[model samples]
Target: MSQEVRTVEQQTPSNRESAQRMALRPVFMPPADIYETKDSIVVLTEMPGVSSEGVDISLERRVLTIRGHSASQDHSGYQRVYNEYTDGDYERVFTLSENIDRDRIEATLKDGVLQLVLPKAEAAKARKIELKSS
Candidate 1:
């Protein structure tokens, strides 16, 4: 084939221009389960059809954003008669608290699930205060 694969960056712009163009596919806000452990806050986002290489996570100021894109399978010779599964992209944003250790944050994607580990800052960690005898 002489054509090259087109990435999301080349096709879709981050900023949505409502008046100028129509969306090619639907954009979904993936469902996330957020919980806190002793040392970290974990977030599990479910984004079907998305892979580790296709996902991007960024933290700016106090906001965290997740963007994922899944390439549609090519149907060169076959024509779609009845379509059930939806082909779309995923996006979500979160506001981080002061207690989160931004520098130590980590993320991983496996089997279409995005896992984010936000470590707690030292100041916010639970530490028992020891009593001293006078």
Candidate 2:
């Protein structure tokens, strides 16, 4: 199994009149760690400020994609001060091989971390064959 990160840019309107009115949103690739076990592959990603309802995961044509959205921070009573960290959306994609069992994939999110488990197919598991002596 292999993992790849891609950045997708949205095209603006071709019309010159409409291009000036369009605004482009920034997309970030969150840091992720992948581990391979004897029977499964585990993927963990850090997505701070993202809630469970704001996450979307999908698999298409052997490509697995994860997207996360974080709500804007609320500072209603206090005036604006020095700012350093910018909150944005997260996007990532991974390519899966035939050895993975897509039907049994599982995922969990907790404390701004996302964990995904990709189980290996039954036929893909390693097995030892015994020989019989006549």
Candidate 3:
């Protein structure tokens, strides 16, 4: 499928500039799926270990940004065993278009998944024109 959303600038630990500050913990770019319908665009982001309260979303000047923070679990009185999963924060940015209705956009987070609904502006929606017999 064609990808609608794109990252402003993908940053990685190794690829990051030297002047850029480092995060104590790993920061991940949460995977997101973008779908377009007749009325709106839907985005689904997967952020495991993140809760609703940990999600932060902002939009300004047609730029949409999402941040998800997750605290690593502290296993008290437990010894280090096999390790697999790591805790970290999520971040992503998308440049939106003028066709989107900014005021009507909606966002919801549930079960570590974030769903965003970007409604299209009235002028952007498809309409059928009827012809009258002359």
TM-score leader: 3
7-80: candidate 2 lDDT, tens digit per residue: 33333323343334234334567888887787888889899988999888887766777878777776799876
Off by over 4 Å in 1: 1-22
Per-residue lDDT of candidate 1, residues 1-134 (tens digit): 11121112223335664212226777677888877777787889999898778788887765677778877865899888888877777877776564568889899888889999988788877778899989
Please report the TM-score between candidate 2 and the true structure: 0.75
Encode model 3's per-residue lDDT on 10-109: one tens digit a residue. 5653325311433566677888888888788898999988878888887877778887878567689987687797787787888765468888989988
Off by over 4 Å in 2: 1-24, 132-134
Best by lDDT: 3
Question: For candidate 1, what is the total of clashing residue pairs?
Answer: 0
Which residue window of length 10 is worst by lDDT in model 3?
A: 13-22
Q: Kindly give the number of clashing pairs for every candidate.
A: 0, 0, 0
RMSD of each: 11.1, 5.8, 4.0
The residue ranges of model 3 lying beyond 4 angstroms of the native Cα positions read: 1-4, 12-22, 131-133
lDDT of 1: 0.72
